[model samples]
Target: MGLIVQKYGGTSVADAQRIQAVAHRIAQRYQQGDQLVVVVSAMGNTTDRLIQLAYQVSPEPEARELDLLLSTGEVVSCTLLAMALRAIGVPAVALTGAQAGIGTDARYGRARILRVDPSRILSHLREGKVAVVAGFQGITEEMDITTLGRGGSDTTAVALAAALKAQRCEIYTDVEGIYTADPRVVPEARKLERISYEEMLELASQGARVMHNRAVELGWVYKVPIYVASSFTEAPGTLICLQEGESMEQRNKVVGIAHDTDVGRITIRGVPDRPGIAAAIFTPLAEAGISVDTIVQNASVERLTDLTFTVAKADLRKAVEMVRHVAQEIGAKEVLWDDVMAKVSIVGSGMQSVPGYAATMFRALYQAGINIELITTSEIRITCLIDASRVEEAVRALHRAFQLEEG
Candidate 1:
């Protein structure tokens, strides 16, 4: 029998009843003779609650100690899940990320997986035991505990799937599948039967929360087929993999729409458009670990240009402070920022080769009376910045414009 790696999100095992339900599902899979390795996130809002508690103790908890505290939530879930399985007469074992051989670099809050040994997992599978591993965390070379950033559990699951060479990796979450747009926003949205890795990565990075981009990238690198579905139901979900032999025409069509409302736009106006000016403005933010997104620079006039970019709204304060300091240092006229912004994106493969796609998107937003602030595009994706309040309207408008509901 082939091996399978299954990952359940926080909502899947939020309580005793939910935990028991997931355990029963895994027990059935084990009874069917598949060697199983299950990964689980902290139950429900456990991680968030832990973070809140940590901050209650200290306004700014040390990253290393915060990771040490956050890692306990997953351990609680994994152990409870193992107990649930054993209660139902199935043999199972719970292992922490370190015990399961997940090794990473020394970064505390957003550590990347360097390697996974899989020796302990192999031993459990050999002993006819189901391995229930904690997700979202690993140990550094120095043996310090580290937590991966948001959506890190998805990364943990895909990394394990690659290491074990599982037949398929299943990601269980709150949503039934990947939809053309956020179903809550676009009621007419349709779920995609399958999506290419490139398209999925773009969607994930753009704003789709069905899975993390890092996990999708890892799966693409290893050529692992990932299945996304709801843990509450058995309905068929979306499959993310290479679309072998798909025609060029088929690849050019828009596949999905993604939007992010947690965006802040900053404009550094009248800066000397000299060499390394961009570097000087951004390097400090990068050093501060503040990610900048959707950058646009206007044409230089008389050796001066306006540079605008977006960052996560949560990082707006720090980003503005750092940019203002840089602006003063570089003799820029002023720094301006707006926190009430959103980014709407459409993604597909080979979209750049197709004509009229960009025009269609802009026309739809314009017709809806949404003002576009900035625009950026990739070979397979196009993104527009607009008012946060109009994001839903813009998403629905673009969804109708692209005719994504037909499929």
Candidate 2:
């Protein structure tokens, strides 16, 4: 029998009924003689509730203690799931990330996985027990508990799959599968049957929430096939693999539209343009773990230019604070930021080899009266920053422009 790794999101096992349903699903697979290892997130909004409770106790909790507190949410779900499986006569055991041998660097809130020793999991699997592991967390070198950042559970599952050499990694979530665009935003957006790793990577990075970008990156690096489908449905789902078939190749140049409303733009106005200026402004943010995206520097007029970049809305304040001192040190006029910005992107693998995709995207946005504030491009994707209020309009317009509905 082949070994399989599966991950259930918080929504997939949100409550008692949902947990039981997931147990039954796992039982069916177990009965078929496949070795199963399941990774699960904290149930429903438990993580959020825990964070709220922590803040109530203290305005700013210590990161190590906060991680220790946050890690319990997944443990609670993991134990409950194990109990459910046992009640149903399915052999099962729960393991926390550390107990399961997930080791990480001590980054606290955003720890990175360093290694996974699957001996404990393998021993349990050999005994015909299903290993239900807590996702999104691990132990540091010093044995302190650490939680992976948002969507860290996905990273956990993929890492385990890679380490265990599982046949495939199945990610069961609330949505049916990966779609041409967010179905809620574009009514006619179609679900793709398959997508290449490169394409999916671009889509995930560009803000398609079906899969986390880090998980996709791990899957790509490990060459692990990932299946994304709904936990509540039997409908056909999407397979993320290394390549698409000839039939899929016949589709339009643009395969999907990805949009993120979590965008915040920062503009350091009237900075003296010179060597090392960009580095001076961005280096501190990097060291602070604030990711800067889509940087644009206006052509210098009289050796002065406006430099702009985007960061996650949640990190906007911290990013501004981190850069303000540097901006002044570099002789800048003012540091300005806008949190009401959003990004929309069109992604496909072969778009760079062809012409006219960018023009079509720009024309569609222009026609919809959505002004493009900034632009960026990769080999396979084009992203535009726009007013957050018009993000839906821009997505719909781009989807129709590229005719993704018919994919």
Model 1 misplacement above 4 A? none
Candidate 2's residue-wise lDDT over 1-407, tens digit each?
A: 69999999999999999999999999999999999999999999999999999999999999999999999999999999999999999999999999999999998899999999999999999999999999999998899999999989999999999999999999999998999999999989999999988889998888899999999999999999999999999998999988845553553368799999889899999999789998888888988888887888899999999999999988999998988989879999999998998999999877777889999999999999999999999988999999999999999999999888876
lDDT of model 1, residue 318: 96
Worst 10 residues of 2 by lDDT: 244-253
Give lDDT: candidate 1, residue 83: 98
Error of 2 at 284 (Å): 0.8
TM-score of each: 0.98, 0.98
TM-score winner among the candidates?
1
